[model samples]
Target: MNETDAKVPVDGSPLELALTAWREALGEAHVVVEPDALEAAQTATFATTQRIPAILRPADTAQVQACLRIAQAHGVPVYPVSGGRNWGYGSRVPAGDGSVLLDLGRMDRIVEHDEQLAYLTVEPGVTFRQAHAWLREKNSSTFITTIGGSPDASLVGNALERGDGRGPHADIFQHVCALEVVLPTGEVVETGHARFPGALAAPVFRWGLGPVLDGLFSQSSLGVVTRMTFWLARKQPYLREFFCTVNDDAYLWDAVDRLQALALDGTLKGSFFFWNDLKALSVTQQYPYASVGRTPLPDPFRDQFREGFGRWAISGALSAPDAEIGALLERRLATALEGAFRPVTFAPPPPDGESHFQGVPSEANLAMAYWRKRTPPPQAPDLDRDRCGFIWCSVALPFTGAQARRAVEIADRVPRLFGLEPNLALLAHSPRCLYLVTALAYDRDARGEDARAHACYRALARELAQAGYFLTRAGLQAQEASPSVRDASSEVVRRLKAVLDPRGILAPGRSES
Candidate 1:
């Protein structure tokens, strides 16, 4: 057979060929090729600050399949993006190298909401807020949701990237039920038993029956995830959030150990996070529940607001009956706070009183609140004076007090070389799975800021990689700066690409050169 038939066709006019194939394979409304419209569509997604891709909108799975087939035939790379709101990570935009950006926003749909099973099946275009709003509107009081940095972020994208949430089920990756993917070969595959005969609606607990493929799509450019199902947390009757303060930096690791133990033993119902004083103030703005605008803590507790206070706070929920909640709280507090310094517990105040731990709006959560205050706000922090970019380095460290302390030391000192303070956050995947130490450096935005920020991040990433720490999500400069992890990750990714997209099409330069 000639090359055209042996493989796919690649000789015709690229744009004409793609448009024609799309028109025949999909409806007219699915294709967009206007230059201005394409640029606008590409920029709408996150993480495309420096580099943008050629935009392609596919309305449904057939369109996606046709686009992938044409790209594979013509050796054109394709990057699939969902909500385009992947922040801090490479965002939804593809890394540069001239690829066809497969926009999934057009496929937004909620395919299934099994209230009895407590799971939601949705397409990549579905956002967290949209899903939550749907659940509320449906009057399905059976499920509660845990969302990431922005409610606008795509549920499938976040889960595929292993994003975390502030609930008992912290890791989004762990909650994945099933996936509907359009692969590079123009074939649509449904993972999990939904594809099996007589199991169209099987519960998604049969991974052991075959090689698990759900994980491959995560953090990979192999395929476009059109739909996914994930488990949701059950709504509780009574929930409470509490903020705990630790005065000494020395006790930070101990506090984490205690918190982890509590979490593992079911003492802590919700997620717990630790932040330094700088991050705390940056997050809350109002310190110690006191200031001119907000109620102020008295002078007796003034020292708590001081710098380097090493704040260890947790939001706890009491889900059981009244009799059980009180007893559970007492036991949990006693065990979790044992032998720690005078740890102050700030619970929701009574009626008409200032409660440090009110059921604050969901937006008041730590991560979102911090970003709102510190990240490029409208009227605050002259970007010229307080201009800062972040080089995020995170790793799965061993879960021990000694290891945590050592990691903290490394986290603290890594940023000092650049005259920046380390902004640290702890992510507990499970009771004993992995403790992620995320360190962020503030690079003042000035002339040649990109180069400087890139250099610092490269150095930090290289050092961590050399010490046997694997980066969860590498930054843009990771390949040039931190060759250890980047080189290894790139190699594995290349091999996977060859097997999945042998025509050198799907996200070409993303993995293999």
Candidate 2:
């Protein structure tokens, strides 16, 4: 057989044999063997060596079950992806080599929605754009929190990765209930009250009577999650876009300290963020390669930019039941950070409408991935196709000024050492913890830059882990080499993987314990 050929004799190699079975299970059109399809499936925002032989697009849960059964019987590994929009991490690339891409994009479906109770059930392929439109069509009173990702990104995929976003339920996993996962062995199971024969509140209740199985499927390689439910935040009568700027690092750290009180006291309504000047710049425009004539922008440019952009900027929303409560929150927020930060600013309360903070998806932030690209960003930017090198190195730290300062000092140096600028942000997920999210954006097509970017990620991840901070979520690149945990903990996880996926036919090396 030729290098690109997928066909073979009636009885052939494991992948070919599996492909034949897959074509029978799902019509040949869905069982794609096109070389271009495989090539696109393996291409990621960052460098990847995995070669996907084919793609299997399952239309529903039952189809997914059939696909898994064939893979199990044929002993061929498959990697499942919901939307393939996991940019900067791995996009849709599999963790291991020679794995088939199990694309679930066709299974997009809004299974159930309840406006009064404020929750929605979604299939693996439901995107933020689709869900937001549904709410608008119904003129619903509640909205779900959305991340600063592509609108096409899947909610189930993001929740399964435990991604954090803007709003009251900023911690995506915390607000989610009932999960329907398809194990590698082709066994289907439902969690929470959904497991009961006839529980009306199945999707509403997070914890069932017995042990919680929803958590096991998240951030693990044991199973593929086909369905999930997300709790919505009721629309408040009053909303204000809140923002602030701090010129000095010391003042920024102090502001972080004071902000925790607001977070703890129920003043900061949702996921607030503090991004450095570079991150802010990246979002607005690409690298000033013409003006600066270099990479890893010089300190002079940073200083000049900081003079106008501030050293660090804070942003989030103030949501309240009434304007009276909103005014109180405003006063409390200002009083809390009075001397610690620069004058706090609020966008003049706009007339009541679909608040962006309350789950309206945006493609603006995605422009950052093209920061280092030489050419102008396309109108519809797809980072993987554009070869935009980006990686998210996020670590959770105690919500304290000192912790923020330490993380910034540590994270800022490594990227620059590799001749790359550090695009960093501090995202508050809760009262007790703040997530320091760093972006390593580069030009992969540039000479030797791809290897450098990957190496920088490995070094960055290692040093951060050594500093007593670990990743909250990682892509395929970071899974294999993650810092070691206690022997007992690692052993238990591996043993569980063994029990759930004996043949390792599912996503292997993903979220390696």
Candidate 3:
């Protein structure tokens, strides 16, 4: 090749030569190796001492493939991240230390939009807020499903991790179609029908001929996704929000049983939430340090907080073709939920277009990290920069009342054993199974606090698994706490990883189980 190839070695290569080639492939300015830059990128919300060697900003598919080729030739492992707002998970931290970070944030591009087919093709750097604004600019009626995390979170990264979102497309992965992935060996290929030349259904069809390979790339260390097509949900004429307070465990248990039919049938659309009082309060206000005057807030005070705000708050949305059908769905909800719990109330979506069902992105819910923070929350929350200690342990359970109640009891009882509050919730995104997501929040600056918080996390994961509920999505810390999570995958993933990434260079140790 030309001088831009940066001279590959005939045998084993040193990391310096690989770095030189990376700077040649991507510009020198995009290849960041500054001490402060690597330090910042390696920092996670949770406690971690792993150091990142460098960060590479690839602007397009060609540059990404080139970077991968250099890393492959030199035996330098690299991890690709989009927008790097993983937050409560691991943020931008890779599975192992000393790996070069491929920051895909510079590849922000809306490649294609087919309004007729109802799909939007985007580069890896495309975020929730960017897509929302793009839809508004085009005056398009359809919208992509959005997550409750940072608006800067990537669409492709979240879908690859099998994240949950709002609206009829609650399961984000279910709404995605074609994928453009750059393999570890420096080859790029398309998934589904996109692999075919001049295939008209590339963006619309999910499965191509032969064996299904779409799921292999998701949550794996197999390849770096450069582009993805997200199927959009059309606008509904009628939209209404349903919310209620559940004070009694029995009442909440029964409600979980009743709500499944609504979701399974057609009464409720989109992902709904059933968060505890701590989750509700954290979103609106910081931890009441002065009033509580303690860590973990004693049982008496905790009970009072729950009593005032109700033990749990149930919130979801209902959508239909028109107001008449919307009203009928409302009646069905009231009949099942209104008797024991407080009256299930309905309201029209806010005029600002920021409603959960509207698929608009917002940073409002990230305040939960500051629940234990001593300082006041900023307009934009940066957990790592502010040392906001947090870890998410989410597990799946059957959509039955007994299962929900038992999981809740275990989650509620275990955290207190570690002197940490059980900031827990049940994200009911599907009818058959719901995730019991628990957040472990603490002050990382305190002495021995990181160890305490991590020990608490391991306990939560172990006990929850013992109760027959395993983690749905795990972070870097989660994988370490429970190695079983990495091994939870089938033998196919392990065998495929050997064939696709023999040197273990691409996102090493990610989604192993």
Give each model's whole-structure lDDT: 0.59, 0.87, 0.85
- Each candidate structure's TM-score, on Cα atoms with residue i matched to residue i, is 0.80, 0.97, 0.95
Worst 10 residues of 1 by lDDT: 352-361
Put down candidate 1 lDDT per residue, 1-513, tens digits, no spaces: 122212222457664566566666665665554455444433311123333334667777877888889877766667788887654555544665556678888788988877777778888888876776777678774443455355667888888877767665667778776688888998887777867767755455637358788877887778888988877766554444555666666676777777777767776655566665545554555233223222222334434555334444433443433546756665676567655444545344244211112111143333422231224343432222233344456676765666667666666666566544455666666776444444343333334545654665666666766666567765344546534433576677778778888886766445322
Query: What is the RMSD of candidate 3?
Result: 4.3
Among residues 3 or more apart in sequence or in different chains, the pairs in candidate 3 whose N, CA or C atoms overlap within 3 Å are 167-270, 486-513, 487-513, 488-513, 489-513
* lDDT per residue (tens digit) for residues 34-115 in model 2: 7777777778988888877788999998999999999998899999999999987799999987788899999888999998
Decide which is better by TM-score, 2 or 3. 2
Better of 1 and 3 by TM-score: 3
How big is the positional error of residue 506 in model 1, measured in Å on the Cα after superposition? Answer: 1.4
Local accuracy of candidate 3 as per-residue lDDT tens digits, 1-513: 122322223343467788888888988999997776777888888877666777899999999999988888888999999989898889999988668899999999999998878899999899999999999889887888888788889999999888888788988998888899999998987889999999999999899877767787888788999999999988777888888888888889899989998888868877888988878877888777888887877767767776667888898888888889988999998998976546888886567445668778878888888888889878878888899998888899999999999999999999899988888889886889899988888888878888998898899989999888988777887866654544435687778888888788998767656
Candidate 1: pairs in clash? 46-84, 78-507, 290-295, 290-296, 349-355
